[model samples]
Target: MKKQITSVSLGQNAKMAAALYVVISLPIVLVLAAILAISGQAGQALVVLVATPVVYAGVAALGTLIGGWLYNVVAARVGGFEFTTAEVKAG
Candidate 1:
């Protein structure tokens, strides 16, 4: 099958990207927090664990929003990317 992504929903993309970013960062943050706490900086660890997600989510959302908007604009001018897909049969 052939497909084209003519446009994207910026709000939806941003939300999904933000959530994915937060989920991806959680484990790294957890490990960093544990290391900081083990190094006798529980306060810093707590701050890192709390603050990192907010920052990551904001950055991810903003970036994705901008990218999606740009894609739509460019796609309008130059047409959207086309690709082919095929379904795999269950063996």
Candidate 2:
């Protein structure tokens, strides 16, 4: 079967992107914070720990929203992404 992605739900896409950004950033943020804390910049480390994910998530959400909106516009003019799929039989 073939299908086309005509448009995206901007709100839902942005929300999911934000969540994924936070999840992806957690490990890197934790390590950076840990290094800063070990270096005696505890306050900065604390701020980094609390703020990095939030900032990254916000940026990701905004970017996703803009990208989705652009995609919608372009899709309307040029047609949407097309792909094929097939059902698999039981093994």
Candidate 3:
């Protein structure tokens, strides 16, 4: 069976996904900063540490919102999206 996605809750979904992305990416950003510092790029590291999370969150949120909107438009024209799911039996 195929399921079609007609619409999405843009604001809510964007915010939630962006928050999760920020949370997951923050640590990776910190590690990158640490690596830069260790490589004698302390100035760059400081900038990255201070700016990455904020920039990343903002961009992620905006991108998600825009993407969702575009998807809705394209889907409407193309009969929406289709996906198939399978059921599994637990042992």
- Model 1 lDDT tens row, 62-88: 999999999999999988999999999
Question: How are the candidates ranked when ordered by lDDT, highest leading?
Answer: 2, 1, 3
Per-model lDDT: 0.96, 0.97, 0.87
Report the CA-based lDDT of candidate 1 relative to the real structure.
0.96
lDDT score, candidate 2, position 45: 96
Ordered by TM-score, highest first, the candidates read 2, 1, 3
**Best-fitting candidate, measured by TM-score?**
2
Model 1 TM-score is 0.90
TM-score on alpha carbons, each prediction = 0.90, 0.95, 0.71
Error of 2 at 35 (Å): 0.7
Candidate 2 lDDT tens digits, 1-91: 8999999999999999999999999999999999999999999999998999999999999999999999999999998999999999999
Clashes of each: 0, 0, 0
Q: Considering lDDT, which of the candidate structures 1 and 3 is the better prediction for this target?
A: 1
- Score residue 77 of candidate 2 by CA lDDT: 96
